[model samples]
Target: MGVTDEVLTEEHKIEIRRYFYNHQNADGGWGLHIEGHSVMFCTVLTYVSLRLLGESSADGDGAMRNARSWIIDRGGATFIPSWGKFWLSVLGVYEWDGNNPLLPELWLLPYILPIHPGHWNSARDQCAKEDLYFPHTRVHEILSSSLHNVVEPLLKKWPLSKLRDRALTMVMDHIHHEDTSTHYLCLGPLNKVLNMICCWVENPNSKAVKCHLARIKDYLWVAEDGMKMKGYNGTQLWDTAFSVQAIVASNLPNEYGRS
Candidate 1:
């Protein structure tokens, strides 16, 4: 869903084109959401999305041209955030080294350690990961603080080593478990795309890729403007809670003498 790897069908392409065109700002760029201001993250993703949907950069309207200029003014796609870089890498539009390490082995950390993921609040863990991805010597500082990072360079140099292979096997198994447990839905669209890519890389002929592809439609939504990817399949529980609150506030039960 987040810069999906799946090839879009002609109908899917049409709907996505409508969605992008409808959402583009007067400045010929996009924001993180419909009402949000234009930012590099959103702009880059939307620009790539349009290209993926078959919009050429040479279009007469100059939408892509304007976006390219805007992105260049902001230091181009290289300035995109970690998640953006990750998606671009999967799309083969960007190099993976631009992203700080997101070693799946981090999930293998012992729970008893103070730095264990189980000990982290979501926000803290997120910040920690972002800090890990920072581009400067700060990345070195962050990596030096983690034992896993300390060994990552050594592992990379010995790609054919038994230890590295075993570690990768473990990571792949963890990924598969995550996919199976989530019913191939993943934590959200971003993770779903990453998981699908990971599975494909590990074994293109594997069932994992088939399952992820099969469920791709779950993340899409058809709106009045056109089709767009939802953050999740549905927020049924959230909507239900709001509906109940609205019903309670209307005093309909009192009017019916139910109270």
Candidate 2:
């Protein structure tokens, strides 16, 4: 894991490409999950991912072209959800100003505060219609509007701006603590990736980034379809328990052990 060479081999690339192609929806787009309906969020993300993997827009038997068409027909990548916008911004495809500020300063507030950013709330209700399962309430809209229009500007002022820097330092401290405690695996794949991004942003050549890079393979798994990112680092204990229960319930393990 300490090796400095590229981790993903050509074979790994081929398998990952196969995994994307294997799970492509009939409409030539992708979904948030393997079995989900094609939505702008996942479709755009998948299309960009394949492009990053060196697939031409005309590749995939025109699957990439169809994906572009699907996105255009649904008002382009602008219709993608907030998470999509964030990643696209990170990838340099979308402008950072387009995204609602996910203030790290929120983390400095008391945990008991009801207005914490961790609450299940959308800062902007502009997701694609397909991904908009829950519409924003009037109260939510008002609060978000106030935050964006009033509170955000005030926070940028001289006195409060000082707090922003302090808040960011505290946020990075928490991220470092989480990474060290989890041995660089973090809580889940999403957080793991986010923490790695944070670590790289803080210092690209730092040991924290190296450790995170070393653990990238922990989330990858291969199946009949191809290589895919697993939902968690590992579930070996859970899988073992489930398998043993199933075998015991069938009485096959007991009967077959003698053979």
Best by lDDT: 2
Best by TM-score: 2
**160, model 1: CA deviation in Å?**
43
Evaluated at residue 74, the lDDT of candidate 1 is 81
Looking at model 1, report the run of 10 residues with the lowest lDDT sum. 120-129
Q: Model 1 clash pairs?
A: none
lDDT of 1 by residue, 1-259 (tens): 4444355667888887788777878776688889778888899998887887778997527778988888998888999888899999999989877889867776799877776556543343344555666544767656654644456657666654668889889988888898999899987889899989999998899999999989888898889989978898767778878876777799665654643
Error of 2 at 79 (Å): 22
Pairs with backbone N, CA or C atoms under 3 Å apart (clashes), candidate 2:
none
The TM-score obtained by model 2 is 0.52
Q: lDDT (0-100) at residue 134 of candidate 1?
A: 58
Q: After superposition on all CA atoms, what RMSD does each candidate show versus the true structure?
A: 11.7, 11.0
